[model samples]
Every structure is written in C-alpha cells, then in structure tokens.
Target: MREEYEIYEQSLPWILEAGEIIKKRIQEHTEIKRKSSHSDVVTEVDREIESFLVSKISEHFPEHNIVGEENVGNRVSSSPYLWIIDPIDGTSNFINRKKDFAISVAFCERDRGIFGIIYDVMAGKLYRAHTGSGAFLNDVELNAAGTDGSLENELMAINAPWGSMEEMKRWEHFFKLGTQVRGVRNYGATTMELSDLATGVLGGYVQYYVNSWDYAAGRVILEELGYKFSDLNGDAIDRVYCGGILAASESLHQQIVQSLKESSKEIK
Candidate 1:
C-alpha cells in the first residue's frame, strides 16, 4: 500500500490543477448529453475534465486503476491503488449555471478509501481529507457539530425527486419529518451537500440514487469528521452503486435510518 501522506500529497496537486482547468472552462459553451434518463445528464465538459484527469493519472501513476464517471473502461484491475473520479458532480447545475457543481476525486487502496477531495469550483471551496488527517475546507480545518438524532432539531438535505412522488403516503411521511426539522434544503449537488455536512451546515443528507464517484470523496471527508453513512436499513456502505443513501453525524444517522425504515414500512 502507498504511504498515507504520500497518496494525499500526490492527489492534492492533481485535484487543484484539475479544478483550475474546470473553472477556466466553466464559462464556455459546452455540449450537453443525457445519460440514463432525462434527469440523468452529462456534458462535454464532463468528458473533457475526466479525460484530462485520467491522462494525468495514467502518465504519473500507470499502475493505478482509474474508475471515472464519464469514462468507464473495460480494463478491470485487482491492483491495490484505485482512483475514483467524478469530473462534475452536478451536471444539471453546471449546464444551467446554477453554481452548485463540484469536482470529486478519491484514492483508495484495496477498496478502502484513503484520500478524498471535493472542489466546489463556483464557490471556490475545496474540501479534502485523508485517513488520519482531519478534514479541511480551503486549508481551514473543519469542526463538525454534534447531534443527538432528534428529528425536531435537525436540518436535513433531501433531494427534490422525493417531493414529487406519485404516492402521497411516502411523500407525506417525508413531509412530516421535513416540517419537524430546523430546516430543509436541496442544493441539487450531492458533493456540496456532503461538504456542508462536514462543516456542520447540514445535519444529514438523504438521496435515492448516487454512484461511487458522486459520494466517495465526500464520504471520506465526512468519516474523518466523526460522521457516518449507511443504507436506509442502517447497513454498512459496502458498495459504490447503492441507489438509496443516508449520511449524517453518528447521532443523527440512526435517527434518520429508523425514520426511513418506519416510513418505508408504512409506504409499503
């Protein structure tokens, strides 16, 4: 395995360099494309950024396995080093110029995350964390807030799709909890939401669908800050393709999970 600090040190420059490139091209007219559905999207800038990052990693560390959102190659490797990249976490926001997008990158060894970097280009914020090192935003160490899982006092970040569900039961369940929280927000960007969680701006984030690239970097940073993540059932987050995700501080995580479980049962 690569030395902990060395991996972080090597990734920091690359992530910052990539963020610069992305920021420069943010104003350009980039081509947009749909991925799995109309709501699922991608842009030419996404491809360009991923290509640029993959090339840099390949040139510098040819042995590492790269898993990118825009480009998923056929070359599967069992190597210890794996680099996960999400060129743009919020493509819709990027295309619409909404300014909530982010560039996410994570390095893992033997499937264990070691370093995570999430750069909010529009906001000029960078959230980075390594295994033992504390999380930081723009070089300032982040102090995570404590929570005791009381739904009444929590501020939750949930996706917009949940509000438009056809069945009123699930929607009502979510609404009931939504009204009890201190507040509710939808940034349309998972990375930013997770970054906000790390900095204590959000009590937790709930989303229905996200890939490894979307959550890996944020997950590492949150974990370093004494936060936790799991499926709705409170199981370990062992895979990258989980659609339903629940992330929060240790205290709030269980409360959210229990609420979700009860809601799921009710909706069923």
Candidate 2:
C-alpha cells in the first residue's frame, strides 16, 4: 500500500505536466496524419506528449520499459516494470471536439498494475487509482460499479468493428447488446468511455478490439471499484493486447456475454 502511494504520487506530476503540454499545444495548429486507415489518425501533439512522458519515465525509473501508442522511445519486449501510455487517448476528439480527449497512463510491475491515471485535460478532471486504493475523479472518490447490478434503463457504450456497428445487421453480438440496454453511446475514445464506467455513469462498455494502452489504465481504475474487465468470451486478459473487451459489473458482464454468445451472425 505504501509503495503504491509512493508510485502514485510520483506519477501524478509527470502525467499532469504532460497534460499541460497538451493543453498548450491544442490551442495551436496541429499536424495530423493517417495510420492504418483514413479513420485511424495520430497528431503531432500525441507524439510530443508521448515523447515527453517517455523521457520522464526514463529519467525517474530508468530500467522501466515503455509501450506507448506513439512508439516514442526505447521499447523492450519485456521488463519487470512497464509503463503503458496513450498520450492523447482521443486524438480525433482533440482535433474535432477538443474537450473530450484525455491522457492515459498505467504503471505495471510485471503483470500487475500498480496505478493508473487518466487526465481529462480540457476539463481539468483527473481520474486516478492505485491497487487497493479507491478510484477518484479530480479529488472526489467515485462509487463502485454495478451498484444495482442491473442494466435496466442504464446507458451503454459500445465500441466494436466500426463497420459492424454502423451497419445494423453486421455483428449480431454488438447489435443485440444495443437492444438489451436503454440506450447506447460511443465517444470514439476508450479512456473517456472507461472513465464513465469507473464513475458508474456508464452501465457498461464493450469493444471488439483495443490496444494495450487503450484500456490498461482504465482496467486498473475500474477493477478497484468492483468492476470487471474481460475479453468478449469472458476469458482473462493480458496487459499486452486482446481481441475485444466487456466491462461492467460481474453479473451484468455475464449477462452481456451470454447475449453476445447466443446472438446469430445476422439478426433475423
């Protein structure tokens, strides 16, 4: 516990400093470029903030390995300590909405996460959590997830195959979950979506595929509050990456999982 706090305190400043850089850079003209596809994008600010944070980890925790979305620095295949980072979790949001983006970081010792931090830069809302400690948004502690363990009338966030989600008849699993909930919302940003789950504002969240940096921090924060995270098939997930994710309360997660498993390829 003491060690977790120590690491958390040390991490706060480094991440906040990176947030400041993003706030400043967001106001200026940004250079945007495409990645795997036209919809997959990265910005100059993303690279800059990631490089800045990588340097901090290198200086403060020299032996730690870093795996950032931007691929900023010296990366390794494995290390005792690893820092997963998404300097700008919502790069497209930063470019479009400007206020919906966040900076996400998670520190892990081997396979266990020590702490996680997600800073909603424009809103000045910093969500953080350490193992055994409670989750927080800014200074206020957040409530546990699945308070009622019921999904009735609760908002759901779905992130899956873009095309599958767009075309109603595509992926029956995603489409079915949408009907089971009161309503559905997608921020196109995993950190924000996960924070909503951590805060209990969102009843549940699911994604067909995501990188390690996308949900590593959120997984730490949510798990502390009794929330559950697993691959769509309800299997344990590793920190590296996975096919998909289903996050919610234990019971609710299983219910959703069952729904996904039973749904046919195309809705009849």
Taken over the whole model, the C-alpha lDDT of each candidate is 0.80, 0.85
Candidate 1 accuracy as lDDT: 0.80
Report the C-alpha lDDT of model 2 over 1-268, residue by residue, as the tens digit.
Answer: 6865787899899888888898788889999999999889999999999989988888877777888998988588545888899999988889998888899999888888789999989989999999887889988998876545665677889875756435745565787778888889899899999998887778899888889899999999999889888998888888776578888988888888888887853454
Q: Candidates' TM-scores?
A: 0.91, 0.93
Q: Please report, as a residue range, the 10-residue window in candidate 2 with the lowest summed lDDT.
A: 162-171
Model 1 agreement with the true structure over 1-268: per-residue lDDT tens digits: 3476776887777778887887788788787778778878988888888887888777777878888888743134767778889989988888886489999998887668788999998888989988777889998999865756587777789763543456455555566557668899888889989988888778998876678889999998988888888875678876365577889887788877777767667767
What's the lDDT for residue 44 in model 1?
81
Clashes per candidate, residues 3 or more apart or on different chains: 1, 0
- Runs off by more than 4 Å, candidate 2: 164-170, 265-268
Top-TM-score candidate index = 2
